[model samples]
Target chain A: MTSTIVTAAILAIGDELLSGRTKDKNIGHLADVLLLSGIDLKEVRIVADEQDAIVEALNALRKRYTYVFTSGGIGPTHDDITADAVSAAFGLTCEHDAEAMRLLAEMYKRREMEFTEARQRMARMPKGARHIANPVSTAPGFIVDNVYVMAGVPQVFQAMVDNILPELQKGSHLLTRSLPCPYGEGDIGTLLGAIQKAHPETSIGSYPKYDGQRFSTELVVRARDEAKLDAAANAISDMIRGLDAARAGSNPGPEA
Target chain B: MTSTIVTAAILAIGDELLSGRTKDKNIGHLADVLLLSGIDLKEVRIVADEQDAIVEALNALRKRYTYVFTSGGIGPTHDDITADAVSAAFGLTCEHDAEAMRLLAEMYKRREMEFTEARQRMARMPKGARHIANPVSTAPGFIVDNVYVMAGVPQVFQAMVDNILPELQKGSHLLTRSLPCPYGEGDIGTLLGAIQKAHPETSIGSYPKYDGQRFSTELVVRARDEAKLDAAANAISDMIRGLDAARAGSNPGPEA
Candidate 1:
């Protein structure tokens, strides 16, 4: 409910995602969660699990956004290098967290598995990071500065996010109203642009959807101000009505 | 075929996507298409519908990758500023192309609709750009320099990619083989890392999958050299067999 403009960026770290082997389920889910929580998702970058690439993208996003949420590259495998990259981005020492190690060790004991050296890799985090709980898996995700390093697995990432969202700062809710226009963008683009100019506070967008045979446009009006969003929606509705009436009147006659 | 290392990046532009109202389907589709076509997808960026942001991301990607493929923001609406932003990215003038105008006009004429100023907006392209045909809709996407501007609609974006991909330089085919390890990443990470170090020519990735109960890992080895790929795959297969044997022997009693 605060008018604060809290923004976020998602940095997906995995070669599998870039290879088309794994379609990213985390970005859209995070985007939806952030938007509903009143945080604006500004940019999303999908980089391979290369440390340099992860560090570069992470540094860039973390510097600009209120929060930089990263997924992948935090497992036990050698390819899991996100924590190291995030540490490098912040110029901090990455070492095993005593608490994380204890939690993971306890989880392994419960599962009747050895706490192998490789599994202990999951306990490593940047210095001074608060662990985000993973309800599904025992290994925890960590938040260092504004960067929240998360697992690539969809279920774990979602679970970690559910834990993280309640702790972050919320912004003004971005209100939106969608009106379906029977006509396509061609019929309403110019008028829509004018409405946008008239209501400068609103961000008006026309998205075209095709249903096999013909095209239709959906007019979405978004604004932080509810009054401005409503005004823009009304203008678009009026424009659509005018177009429909004109088309109806000309149905029986030839072009002028 | 050719062993040229062609790399590409995808720039998905839309506010709806960032807002989470629209789930993105183009990035992964493009990634799959690019990988199968022998072009390596190096990066994927999802940006909002701002012209400055588009230009910044487009320039950054186009300069680094062999090709930068963009989707969204090419429709007739005001929010469709990708064409102009791309033109700015390459420092070229955006104007109506004669051939594009003819094609769009003909499409409108055939549909018995007026070729309004809004619809005519679809014909504009950067100077010295070549049109990429959209089979779904007559309005063509365009390519300027190494940047391919495409539609946002999944059907149209895919059709445009079909037309543009064959014309680009194909890289060496990236061959891969997947071996499912019954053990999770914690069980095989150390050995997998050793295997990767032994075969520097191949890239090994261990992805963990959970089916609600237990976690299993999928080890994928990728290499351009077939012999090297097979050699690494065999090493991973041997490692998995060793782990399976050790587990089977231990199941009869307590840990050794």
Candidate 2:
């Protein structure tokens, strides 16, 4: 509904992720980066390293969102098939990229090691794709069309995100305001619903947290327009205050 | 293909997750639990609180995997519409269930709180769905067909997984053996590929780790059958030792 919102979907590829051997650190990191950049991370899909699964998820996500960011399976291993899978998804041929190969060759030369066939795998990408720099690791990630391919390692992925983010076109920033309501959701649910209905453009989310001693709800109102956000947040605050006053009148204590 | 492998997909529902306001704590926890239970978590999807998005993802995952687990948006708030989305997905009416209402009413009575319309929303479920107990909170998750809906709270989600795991019939345990290769993936990539080709049934995953000083690859072979696992693991060990011997003949150093 917000036309100015730039949407993205993340495709996390690796067998270790699905097998529970590796806990993914890239999704949240990318999510935070995208949020700050005014891009809406709309969906995330985690699939195994199988080429078909990766290709399927990649194509689907790329078609749905403004950008598709893929993490993992871009390393120097037999299971590092993200490049090939992504190429396949775009109907492009995978080949060793010149700049990527140059970077890897230089790094390997400095280490006095052979850039073997397996090591060279890190240089492969879909033809015509531009390379994204990786300061942490010598191997580079690539960007093709709307897809940005990055490494799976937390440090390398974060670096690539930083390097690529500046080149992206910015969109309208989504404004958000969080109000901590001491009352339970049950106590203020009706009033909150009325506020949401009144301000249909703003998305009001109620998240309840129980801290052993008491239950509290954090009401987050998000919208593209600042006016809508302010209206919804003010309405929510008034509802919370009304509930608090009623509770105090009955209980007549600070605990209320 | 491992026909005996029971596959599952997780659908994480919430606008908070998509907006990056909430770092998802449920996926990794569920993945670890499902892996230990002999169920392969094939895919995971994080979608917004919108009913259409939830229903679309839920239907897609339910039909694709042996089981589907959904977490979040099942609370007492206007935005908590997961039950309605799920019911719409299955063409089942969403209404208050007697057992769920009874459980929630008792809990509210114990706390001397009013079970308002919003609080009662937690008791709604699709027709013919059975309730899954929530010891952390009285509002129960539900299981309809192959879908298991659960809370988004980490503690509550984990408790539901523990409670429901024993009830489902488990498949053959996926056995895995990891061999720590001192050599990098590039050093053993070709040999590892040959070994993988020789053993078609076992899935060999190469995970490279850099521990500051050196880069090493951990070769993890997973299979349902024990014989296939042992065969693949032996082949991998032999390949690593062959690389080690070759390295020693060339360098003849303690590092080699």
Candidate 3:
């Protein structure tokens, strides 16, 4: 269990995110990636760009999870303070890194944009931090200790994460299967209860959706073992199909 | 400042949340509530329902933030182990609560449904925990020390929080105002930079939006001080309006 265990936490920093103006879709994306990789997503946090708040969150989450990924607050704007806050969390002073500056300088030269003082702020890094390569934007993300500080924008963050994921340690992947049922949870609740009782290793979830005219349910089966997951899903699917077939046979079709 | 400061971190639990299948909107909603009441949202975390994962996250977040609000995993399903994990975090025992049982019994009676063992499982609460009244659902959320455990469903979780918020301590409220400009961020970036320099107490954010054919910008002013927020917004608004007026005068009307 110890060898298979891996945990991760996400810290999203920005005022735009807190205001509900910018709906954070990245949390879900990262969570899925970590889950598939068998890294348990232990926690996620959203904080304002205030240094104190970000620092406090970083310190706490880093100590708990194996890895902490932070998004937002790493941009060129004055409000971008994730790097500074991360540095503060580790009790390190922030400085403009020569390597980071070189990367930004090259990016600016290629784009033909002035590398002004404001833009230069993007090159600042916490002491002893290594840059996470950002292909889309010139200003690379940095990794300090176990924390992976990446961009807020989805595309850039995804690219940065994709670049870094292969290098990190991974655990056995989580497995899952879903069976769609035309009936509501009420109709299949008893069968689900029996299925759950029999398969303690598998987790079964019932999700109900209403499409205005009709109601449908999606029963999902999940487990760490691929064979167990498939077996459990097949059993549940067979049970649901059996019930449907029995009802159809007894009723002998509405047209008849 | 210490006396006036109130902090909160949201812990979202369950595999469904980490997956893109379900977008966790509770973080944004809770952030707005916390901000409006002057309680700073320090962080938000999404974790799977594994015991150690949940325990580590709860323990870490509860210690760092003044208040920790957790959503999801407190249901009848097998994956719903937030209460158990939280209890483990505090080194407490989980037990069936008389108050919660009574509430569940009443709810079941009102709905004319049998209060089965599975439904009764929802009544289990960590020792010495106080119940957070839920008007929408009978499964009352619990508060143990600094941690508030709420439902995963958006409406139910919000209802539980609404009942709990009034009872909790609040900090100084954050105030914000938005001023829109017809030009893009690049056009008014210089003026916005000056506004930040002049009002160091306030944070100015510039957001650019492209509506297919044209580009527009919204400059937002935010601060803990209401007067400072309003003043900064007014100054930014004046500068933007002046730019628009200058453009109007220089270009003249289409007819002219």
RMSD of 3: 5.3
The best-first sequence of candidates by TM-score reads 1, 2, 3
The candidate, 1 or 3, that scores higher on TM-score is 1
Candidate 1 residue pairs that clash: none
**What TM-score fits each model?**
0.96, 0.94, 0.77
Instruction: Report lDDT per candidate.
Output: 0.90, 0.88, 0.78
- Stretches off by above 4 angstroms in model 2 are A1-3, A251-256, B1-3, B211-214, B250-256
Q: What 10-residue stretch in candidate 3 chain B is worst by lDDT?
A: B206-215
lDDT of 2 by residue, B1-256 (tens): 4547688999999889887788888898888888788888899999988898888889888999999999998888899999999999999999999999999999989999999998999999998899899988878999999999999878888889988999876778899998888888777776787888899989999887766556777889998889989999999888877877887797787665
- Interface RMSD after interface superposition, model 1: 1.0
DockQ-derived CAPRI band for the predicted complex in model 2: medium
How many clashes does the backbone of model 1 have?
Answer: 0
Tens-place lDDT digits, model 1, residues A1-256? 3368899999999999999898789998898889888999999999998888888898889988999999998999899998889899999999999999999999999989999888999999999899999889889999988999899999899999999988899998988899989998988888888898999988998889988788998888888988888888888888987987787785744542
Computed on C-alphas against the true complex, the DockQ of each candidate is 0.80, 0.70, 0.26
lDDT of 3 at B246: 77
Candidate 1 vs. true structure, TM-score:
0.96
